[model samples]
Target: MNDEPKSISIKDIAEALNISIGTVDRALHGRRGVSEKTKTRVLKTAEQMGYKPNLAAQALKLNRRISIGVVLPKHISYFFDPLRAGIRAAAGAAMGSQISLEFHEYPRIGSGDIEALEAAHARKYDGLIFLPGDIQRFSPLIRKISRSGTPMMCVGSDAPDTGRIGSVSAHAYISGSIAAELLAHKLPRKANVAILTGELSTLDHAEKLSGFAATLAIQAPHLTLMPTLEGHEKPKEAYRQALTLMRQKDRPEGLYLSTANSIAVIEALEELGLLGKVQVVATDLFQDLATLIKSNKILATLYQRPFTQGKVAFENLVAYLTRGNLESPVVQLAPHIVLRSNLPLFASRISETDEGEPESDSLE
Candidate 1:
């Protein structure tokens, strides 16, 4: 009464096609030594037989455990938390790969990043996933680590002309352009707009400022651009700068928080009772940001896909290390613009955190 198809294995595929088991295995696994015509035949036969390769079993054959070092900032947990979540999700997907992820957290970018890099380098991991702060400061160290045989994969931002094998991040320049375009439309009349961001030494923050300034000059020439306020992603510093910027005689009509450290600036805006009066464009999203968005306190946010960036970075690094697939790919995900109208679609991704606090544990 039961007529179900059995699972097809490589042996079944080889037998069905009258080929050697070794040839079938080599072709299926993309191992060299198999002819092109034979590989095509084996692939066709495997597909026709509905064979599925077990990645875990394939990895088990390698007889080695892969270890990865992840170095990221502890500040701005609103973005970094989801980034770690993504890396964990990717590691989970590759279960039985015998992969170990070691997370090393620094206070913030440009602070303890170099020390963390040195510590992780001493361990001699197979690969590293890192967020580069200042290119000039990190170039020599990254090159040293690479020359020592560990591949470095940059995430969140890039350090070019260095030894980084690949990078995965949201398009930072486009995020700024989007913010500028949004504010330009909201304030059709001549108005002043200011950018609140992190240190200019960080590549991502600098790129965002560049994009916003360029777009404002081209599309919204009537809008006056104010001097950038660099809080260096410190909460107290950001709050103080924001408060001063808002209280100035030449107060800006529009504000763009280019970094994920928007809560402090938002609090300052609230303190000055300029919540709804000033059009504010924030970065990333959390529970508090969602509430603010619904209450019209914030206009829009450019959601950088942090989780995807981490997931892709981990997956690509694994592929490069295990399969010798050194494509050195640079993946740039487009920033998701979240408005009040379509906020519900992105509700599932929002983390339930009132404050941006970093996690304590380093090993997982």
Candidate 2:
């Protein structure tokens, strides 16, 4: 009465099919020299036999190590910390596969991002997973890296026009539309709405704004739209901008935060005694933002699944390096809207952090 599960082996499949072991190996691995008919037969037989490749054993047999570099912005810890944790967790799970992840943090945007990209290139890592600050600005570098035959995967943000291998992120435009749709059902008629975001040059932020504006136009035309306030990914900057916007005679009745600086915006609203008065829709979930949503101060916040994005980005790059499989050109994760009713369920999973490490203005 053995309780251990039985393992399927290639040799067993080959013997059962009365085919040479070499032929079975080539067909199973998708290598050249295997006829399509034979390949199909091998796959069908393998599936019937419940064949599962021993990834660790395969890695040991190869006797090779895959090195990947991760470049991300550390300016906002609430978002990127969970992402980093996910990458580390995935790397730990792949311990026997000999995959190493080297992390490098840069400023949220500008020349610092370029310098980090350059440093990553100089290191000649086997692969790269990065969050692009500005696609147009980094197009050339991205192209150069791709032309060098190194695989690159974009995380959180994408450089689609560039020759990067793939991307993993939330559906930016759809997320924006969700925010607009949520606000439309909650806000008063003829309410004024304003958006606070990071740089518009970045693809992610720009797409979010575009989606939000389009959805609002269709679903909530009564809500007045105001010009965007650029926060530059800084809490203090966002606080100042939020304060200034609220002071105006035509202060916004609804606020949409397209970046991860909701804490600053909430603080500003609290200071002006408008925390519960003005409806708010924010992006990403941190402990503070979750608490705000639970208290009904912030209307709702979108959870982008940053941790899963990081893990997928690393896994995709590793797959390309080891098996030459690019799962897809872009992998967009769906976002979940968290409101007061659902805050308790998501509270334990929130990326709880008071503050991130200090950031510098320039790359050192």
Best by lDDT: 1
Clashes of 2: 0
Model 2 clash pairs are none
**Model 2 lDDT at residue 86:** 75
**Which stretches in model 2 have alpha-carbon errors above 4 Å?**
1-61, 95-97, 353-364
Off by over 4 Å in 1: 1-61, 95-97, 326-328, 352-364
Cα-lDDT of candidate 2: 0.80
TM-score of candidate 2 to 2 decimals: 0.81
**RMSD, one per candidate, in order:** 10.8, 10.4
**TM-score of every model versus the real structure:** 0.81, 0.81
* Model 2 C-alpha lDDT per residue in residues 340-359, reported as the tens digit of each score: 99887676567643222211
Clashes of 1: 0
Candidate 1 vs. true structure, TM-score: 0.81
Task: Give the C-alpha lDDT of model 1.
Answer: 0.84
